[model samples]
Target: MSVDRDTVLKIARLSRIKLEDERVEPLMGELNNILAWVEQLDGVDTTDVAPMTSAVETSLAWREDQVSDGECAEDVLKNAPVSEYGFFAVPKVIE
Candidate 1:
Protein backbone atom coordinates (compact mmCIF):
# COMPACT_ATOMS: atom_id res chain seq x y z
CA MET A 1 0.00 0.00 0.00
CA SER A 2 1.36 3.38 -1.06
CA VAL A 3 0.76 6.51 1.06
CA ASP A 4 0.03 9.75 -0.76
CA ARG A 5 0.81 13.36 0.28
CA ASP A 6 -2.83 13.93 1.23
CA THR A 7 -2.85 10.75 3.38
CA VAL A 8 0.35 11.94 5.11
CA LEU A 9 -1.24 15.33 5.83
CA LYS A 10 -4.35 13.62 7.20
CA ILE A 11 -2.21 11.37 9.45
CA ALA A 12 -0.19 14.39 10.68
CA ARG A 13 -3.41 16.25 11.52
CA LEU A 14 -4.84 13.18 13.34
CA SER A 15 -1.58 12.75 15.33
CA ARG A 16 -1.44 16.51 16.14
CA ILE A 17 1.98 16.77 14.43
CA LYS A 18 3.23 19.88 12.63
CA LEU A 19 4.95 18.84 9.36
CA GLU A 20 6.81 21.10 6.92
CA ASP A 21 5.60 21.04 3.29
CA GLU A 22 8.93 19.67 2.01
CA ARG A 23 9.02 16.86 4.63
CA VAL A 24 5.60 15.47 3.62
CA GLU A 25 6.84 13.46 0.57
CA PRO A 26 9.63 11.67 2.47
CA LEU A 27 7.30 10.98 5.44
CA MET A 28 4.72 9.51 3.04
CA GLY A 29 7.35 7.23 1.47
CA GLU A 30 8.47 5.98 4.92
CA LEU A 31 4.88 5.37 5.96
CA ASN A 32 4.23 3.45 2.70
CA ASN A 33 7.34 1.28 3.29
CA ILE A 34 6.09 0.46 6.82
CA LEU A 35 2.66 -0.47 5.45
CA ALA A 36 4.22 -2.66 2.73
CA TRP A 37 6.30 -4.51 5.34
CA VAL A 38 3.14 -5.09 7.39
CA GLU A 39 1.41 -6.43 4.28
CA GLN A 40 4.30 -8.87 3.81
CA LEU A 41 3.87 -10.06 7.42
CA ASP A 42 0.18 -10.76 6.73
CA GLY A 43 1.19 -13.55 4.26
CA VAL A 44 3.03 -15.56 6.97
CA ASP A 45 1.21 -18.59 8.50
CA THR A 46 1.15 -19.07 12.32
CA THR A 47 -1.25 -22.02 12.61
CA ASP A 48 0.68 -24.03 15.24
CA VAL A 49 2.25 -21.19 17.28
CA ALA A 50 1.10 -20.97 20.90
CA PRO A 51 0.20 -17.58 22.43
CA MET A 52 2.81 -16.39 24.95
CA THR A 53 2.27 -14.22 28.06
CA SER A 54 5.96 -13.94 28.93
CA ALA A 55 9.24 -14.49 27.05
CA VAL A 56 10.99 -16.29 29.99
CA GLU A 57 9.70 -19.55 31.59
CA THR A 58 10.19 -19.17 35.34
CA SER A 59 8.24 -19.26 38.65
CA LEU A 60 8.06 -16.37 41.14
CA ALA A 61 10.34 -16.83 44.20
CA TRP A 62 8.34 -16.11 47.37
CA ARG A 63 9.15 -15.94 51.10
CA GLU A 64 7.12 -16.85 54.23
CA ASP A 65 4.39 -14.26 54.99
CA GLN A 66 4.90 -13.75 58.72
CA VAL A 67 5.25 -10.66 60.91
CA SER A 68 8.68 -10.14 62.50
CA ASP A 69 10.30 -7.81 65.02
CA GLY A 70 10.78 -4.27 63.73
CA GLU A 71 12.77 -1.19 64.82
CA CYS A 72 11.59 0.75 67.92
CA ALA A 73 9.15 3.65 67.14
CA GLU A 74 11.31 6.16 69.10
CA ASP A 75 14.42 5.01 67.14
CA VAL A 76 12.63 5.65 63.82
CA LEU A 77 11.11 9.00 64.94
CA LYS A 78 14.50 10.27 66.29
CA ASN A 79 15.49 11.64 62.82
CA ALA A 80 12.16 13.43 62.21
CA PRO A 81 12.02 17.25 62.32
CA VAL A 82 8.76 16.97 64.28
CA SER A 83 7.20 13.87 65.93
CA GLU A 84 4.38 13.20 68.44
CA TYR A 85 2.68 10.11 70.00
CA GLY A 86 4.85 7.57 68.07
CA PHE A 87 4.15 9.36 64.72
CA PHE A 88 5.63 12.04 62.46
CA ALA A 89 3.69 15.34 62.62
CA VAL A 90 3.32 17.73 59.71
CA PRO A 91 1.38 20.92 58.97
CA LYS A 92 -2.35 20.36 58.31
CA VAL A 93 -3.29 21.10 54.66
CA ILE A 94 -7.11 21.12 54.85
CA GLU A 95 -9.47 22.73 57.39
Candidate 2:
Protein backbone atom coordinates (compact mmCIF):
# COMPACT_ATOMS: atom_id res chain seq x y z
CA MET A 1 0.00 0.00 0.00
CA SER A 2 1.30 3.44 -0.95
CA VAL A 3 0.98 5.54 2.21
CA ASP A 4 0.77 9.17 1.06
CA ARG A 5 1.06 12.29 3.25
CA ASP A 6 -2.76 12.80 3.25
CA THR A 7 -3.30 9.15 4.25
CA VAL A 8 -0.74 9.50 7.07
CA LEU A 9 -2.48 12.63 8.36
CA LYS A 10 -5.83 10.80 8.34
CA ILE A 11 -4.24 7.85 10.15
CA ALA A 12 -2.76 10.16 12.80
CA ARG A 13 -6.10 11.93 13.31
CA LEU A 14 -7.97 8.61 13.66
CA SER A 15 -5.37 7.28 16.11
CA ARG A 16 -5.63 10.49 18.27
CA ILE A 17 -1.88 11.15 17.86
CA LYS A 18 -0.69 14.80 17.58
CA LEU A 19 1.97 14.32 14.88
CA GLU A 20 4.11 17.30 13.76
CA ASP A 21 3.97 18.38 10.06
CA GLU A 22 7.63 17.39 9.48
CA ARG A 23 7.06 13.89 10.90
CA VAL A 24 4.24 13.06 8.43
CA GLU A 25 6.53 12.50 5.37
CA PRO A 26 8.91 10.25 7.30
CA LEU A 27 6.05 8.34 8.89
CA MET A 28 4.37 7.86 5.52
CA GLY A 29 7.59 6.43 4.06
CA GLU A 30 8.03 4.07 7.04
CA LEU A 31 4.41 2.84 6.81
CA ASN A 32 4.72 2.18 3.06
CA ASN A 33 7.93 0.18 3.64
CA ILE A 34 6.21 -1.95 6.31
CA LEU A 35 3.27 -2.69 3.98
CA ALA A 36 5.69 -3.68 1.17
CA TRP A 37 7.52 -6.11 3.49
CA VAL A 38 4.22 -7.66 4.60
CA GLU A 39 3.17 -8.01 0.93
CA GLN A 40 6.40 -9.93 0.29
CA LEU A 41 5.49 -12.41 3.09
CA ASP A 42 2.30 -13.44 1.24
CA GLY A 43 4.36 -15.47 -1.29
CA VAL A 44 5.88 -17.84 1.32
CA ASP A 45 4.70 -21.52 1.37
CA THR A 46 3.10 -22.82 4.61
CA THR A 47 0.52 -25.37 3.41
CA ASP A 48 1.59 -28.16 5.84
CA VAL A 49 2.33 -26.08 8.92
CA ALA A 50 -0.14 -26.33 11.82
CA PRO A 51 -1.22 -23.32 13.86
CA MET A 52 0.42 -23.21 17.32
CA THR A 53 -0.04 -21.12 20.48
CA SER A 54 3.61 -21.33 21.58
CA ALA A 55 7.01 -22.05 20.03
CA VAL A 56 7.73 -24.68 22.75
CA GLU A 57 5.37 -27.66 23.18
CA THR A 58 3.40 -27.89 26.47
CA SER A 59 0.10 -29.19 27.87
CA LEU A 60 -2.29 -27.44 30.27
CA ALA A 61 -2.76 -29.06 33.70
CA TRP A 62 -6.46 -29.18 34.59
CA ARG A 63 -7.93 -30.14 37.97
CA GLU A 64 -11.11 -32.19 38.55
CA ASP A 65 -14.42 -30.33 38.08
CA GLN A 66 -15.82 -30.06 41.63
CA VAL A 67 -18.81 -28.12 43.00
CA SER A 68 -19.05 -27.13 46.68
CA ASP A 69 -19.45 -24.08 48.88
CA GLY A 70 -16.07 -22.20 48.91
CA GLU A 71 -16.10 -22.00 52.71
CA CYS A 72 -18.43 -22.46 55.73
CA ALA A 73 -20.71 -19.44 56.39
CA GLU A 74 -19.24 -18.88 59.87
CA ASP A 75 -15.74 -18.10 58.51
CA VAL A 76 -17.06 -15.55 55.99
CA LEU A 77 -19.45 -13.78 58.42
CA LYS A 78 -16.82 -13.37 61.18
CA ASN A 79 -15.19 -10.30 59.52
CA ALA A 80 -18.46 -8.31 59.12
CA PRO A 81 -18.88 -5.01 61.04
CA VAL A 82 -22.60 -5.83 61.60
CA SER A 83 -23.97 -9.28 60.67
CA GLU A 84 -27.57 -10.42 61.20
CA TYR A 85 -29.16 -13.76 60.31
CA GLY A 86 -25.77 -14.86 58.91
CA PHE A 87 -25.68 -11.86 56.53
CA PHE A 88 -23.81 -8.52 56.39
CA ALA A 89 -25.95 -5.58 57.60
CA VAL A 90 -25.68 -2.14 55.98
CA PRO A 91 -27.32 1.25 56.73
CA LYS A 92 -30.63 1.84 54.91
CA VAL A 93 -30.15 3.95 51.82
CA ILE A 94 -33.76 4.11 50.55
CA GLU A 95 -36.46 6.40 51.97
- Model 2 TM-score, all chains together: 0.47
Q: Which pairs of residues collide in model 1?
A: none
- lDDT, candidate 2, 1-95, per-residue tens: 58888899999999999998889988988999999988987798879987778877888889788975677889999999999999999999898
Off by over 4 Å in 2: 60-95
lDDT of each: 0.89, 0.89
Worst 10 residues of 2 by lDDT: 63-72
State the lDDT of candidate 1 residue by residue for 48-76, as single tens digits.
98879788998889978986767788888
- Per-candidate TM equals 0.46, 0.47
